[model samples]
Target: MNNKLFSVIFSLAVAIALVGPLFAAGGGTALQHANVNVRDTAAVQRGAKLFVNYCLSCHSASYMRYNRLAEDLGLDEELVMDNLVFADVKIGETMDIAMRPADAEAWLGKVPPDLSLISRSRGADWLYTYMLTFYQDESGGWNNLALPNVSMPHVFWQLQGIQKPVYATHDGIEVVDHLTLGKPGLQSPEEYEGTVRDLVTFLDYLGEPAKVKRKNVGVWVLLFLALFALIAYALKAEYWRDVH
Candidate 1:
């Protein structure tokens, strides 16, 4: 029974490991790994800057405060206020946008959702791929392979340039084969990828600010457990020696 149970558990674990990436991709498109490290304060800071300049006007990170951001990224409060705080918001205030919901809905056809937990809801890999996959559709409008018919426009076009989709027939229906850069952007492809990576890294940090500290604590806890187990085993051996 023990062996049977172990086999079943192992099989389930293997299956889950194999299938997990497909679900993370969302909508059948393979996701690019974000390879983000929230512990990298410099990357997080760059991502935060990009978020504020590009995404903040539409999406608000209401859960995160400017003071907390400054503290986490090791920035002086004054520097954050001068650089990051675009609106007339106080340093202690949450990162709320000036755009009213009604106005945003009228302009965008929908109120942009708050992005405080976007990375948690849609994993970092999905977000990273989504950022990179925006392409010019036949209608000359922006579309994404990661999220078909995405309402958002290609906001990073200036940096990453225009990507045109290449289509190929598969089973009588045309499908996107790949994307090609038709126009060059300000940054090289490598530099643009790095920029997107930094942005995703910030989003990842935003989702769970305590992740770094929690991971550190977990390592210490595992070490303590191993030490305790060793001590317990030594006591057990000494106690049994007399009886033997």
Candidate 2:
């Protein structure tokens, strides 16, 4: 009886120990790494440029229309045409990627994530952290899931530098001690953060294309209701004496 009780206690303790990190990082839910600064208009513009230059080739944001972006953002059609709009897509076309999913799985060992609803699905902080947290763990075979033996090689290693997550324990708490860049990337830390913020903004925009418009219209709707109520009250007062 004592041995059985010990086994149960041991199992419970092991389970708690194993699942602790899961809760800390949002309970093993979808990747929620992002530092999305949607309010930064300039940063969003910069991020759009960065994403077009780097990320658009693999992943497609199918829901967003170029025309929508232009109308909402007041973008110059000529500039987007010359610079950000690649793949021979028209100025009014929907955003899409050239990469096929089957080929991507063969190449990267997993399908690339869609960015359309990523901000909604994973949250901004998750996207931000994911962008920043990639590191070199030599054993990660194919797909990396904290399993050191990952096969997927770092695609952005050159841009972000080769990172290896430094692990440490203090006061019995394990942590991702640090991220050290072994090689140089195209951008510095501040530059990279801005870049990530840009992507986050874009993702946020994609997630809710009508958000800005809705917010702008919401105020007017409320004002209309208040004005309508005042007029209604005045009408009621004006009619009150007619029968009398």
Candidate 3:
């Protein structure tokens, strides 16, 4: 019985491991391997700046509006328009990436991803870490899993400096350790890391643009549900007591 149970457990674990990531790969509502709390305002603002400068050329957060971001991030409309808004996108317009797939293919080979729901789809922490963890890859031509064989050059190199991979083997498991940022960029390592954090935060907000509303309303919703349940239980008790 013990051997049979072990065999079943092992088989189930192996099957799930093999098929799970494939099933869950592109489903929105989660970012890829990121854990995020959309409540962090500072992080979200930094993410917005990074998005406009580096990612806006290719990707678009089409579901969001500049005005909404300003309201959520506590920025004035003038500031958002002057600093972060791009390509003549009016303050009221949705954030749309101008690059079509064909256009992106012509240039960068893949359509830059839409990040509007990336937080939900991929998770914020995944974006946060991936943004910072890019390293020079001789194998894929550049090291990035979200993008492999990417024709797009490292856009953040000037800000992030360059990171080279250092490999360590433990128990036959290869691990990346303390990716060293070589040289200096427009932003120091600390500043660049903050930029990445902010970028991830913005993406997190995009994933659920109404997170604030949802969180705020959740308390009321729970209270109502609880009240209804209490009333229902009391009524049930009264009716059942007479029947009993």
Residues 1-244, model 3: lDDT tens digits: 6999999999999999998875554322133344455677777777788788888878887888899889988899999999998587799998887767897878766667777887777566557656766677646355653433446677788888777767779789875544676666789877876767777777777888788678878989999999999999999999999999
Worst 10 residues of 2 by lDDT: 141-150
- Quote model 3's TM-score: 0.69
Off by over 4 Å in 3: 1-36, 139-141, 145-148, 167-178, 186-188, 219-244
lDDT of 2 by residue, 192-218 (tens): 766677778887877987776777798
For lDDT, the strongest prediction is: 1
- lDDT of predicted model 2: 0.71
Which one wins by TM-score: 1 or 3? Answer: 1
Please tell me which predicted candidate would have the highest TM-score against the true structure: 1
The better candidate by lDDT, 1 or 3, is: 1
Q: Judge candidate 1 at residue 71 and give its lDDT.
A: 90
Better of 2 and 3 by TM-score: 3
Model 1, position 152, has a per-residue lDDT of 87
Give lDDT for model 3.
0.74
